[model samples]
Target: MISENKIYFYPIWLRIWHGINAMGILILIVTGINMQFSNPKFGLVNFELAVNLHNISGILVTINYLLFFFGNILTSNKRYYRLKRKGLFKRLQLQVDYYTSGMFKNQQPPFPLSEKRKFNPMQKVSYLTVMYLFVPGLVITGLALLFPETIIENVYSVSGIFLTAILHASLGFLVSIFLIIHLYVASIGKNPLNNFKSIINGYHDIHGH
Candidate 1:
């Protein structure tokens, strides 16, 4: 149950989308690592199974990403991710300082989470890059890999598959790094579990808000 002090931070669509997106990304990450390494002793699943799971999860995540994109637009929730043109660098610097220095001292964030601006400046930039740029790049490259004979051969004069594979693997590595940072920061809210709980239940306990 949500308490009076808590504010509704996530809507139903966002919650559902986020849940599916997170699960799909996790599955993709695990399967991707297994497929990339191909070490039988350390395999989470067989190589064939990993490939099938990765493809399925990637497709599902792409669909969910579209849902998130359209849902935010329809609901006007995309504003939360809009970066402020004015003082953007300053805000980003402050946020960086807070994370690197202040956070260790238990200092409050420079830009606290709120109903209006759910993300800080840094988050806005990072999330925007990830959602709009990185995700689309990954999806396109993944699709090319999926239909290599049809897409890759015609698209590139030579080494199309190799190039596509490099791009896909590079993006996957970047997404994994981003996920690690995201989970670490999510644990740094008012309480260790505050961010996780908010995502799960929609209610966020903003201290003194």
Candidate 2:
């Protein structure tokens, strides 16, 4: 029989970070949509307010992410981020196989949890990429928009304001796509609310390495 013991998993800080991050991303998405479709002659109805709110939310998200980074360090959760010697493509392929075939055949997950490495194979790739690539990219672009003067001073060779705006919008769209996929995948736990409950109460009763 499966164990039913309540084991501590996600900590309170992580729960707070997750909730805040989700909300911040949602706000950004709503504002982004409004800004994208604004009618210029409508007297700055959606464009002005949406862009303002989005920038505020971006600032909050940046602060929240820094706190999350510090929390991970304090809790020694950085071990989960250490990549294995195995190649990224190989590891990704293995995870894909497990999800496609093994999961349906009662086979165990290829890469399971431990005190050190709690993330599964796919999570290792996804979360790491989000942090190192997506989040940083978005933050940099947002900051450039927030302080065009300073940025232009630093990088005099920049293409132009319009080019920068294009880049920022592209990254924001990518983040929105990731958020949707992440939310859908979060629902695929032992139960519909299993993952969410784990984040809330810090326990998920499952076997792992």
Model 2: per-residue Cα lDDT at residue 117: 56
Lowest lDDT 10-residue stretch of candidate 2: 150-159
Q: Candidate 1 local accuracy as lDDT?
A: 0.84
Positional deviation of residue 183's Cα in model 1 after best superposition, in angstroms = 0.3
lDDT (C-alpha) at residue 180 in model 1:
96
TM-scores across all candidates? 0.91, 0.84
Model 1: residue 85 alpha-carbon error in angstroms? 2.1
- Model 2 bad stretches (over 4 Å): 1-3, 40-45, 70-75, 153-159, 207-209
Q: Kindly report which residue pairs in candidate 2 clash with one another.
A: none
Q: Rate the local accuracy (lDDT) of all candidates.
A: 0.84, 0.77
Best by lDDT: 1
Question: Model 2 — TM-score against the truth?
Answer: 0.84
Clashing pairs in 1: none
Off by over 4 Å in 1: 1-3, 40-42, 154-158
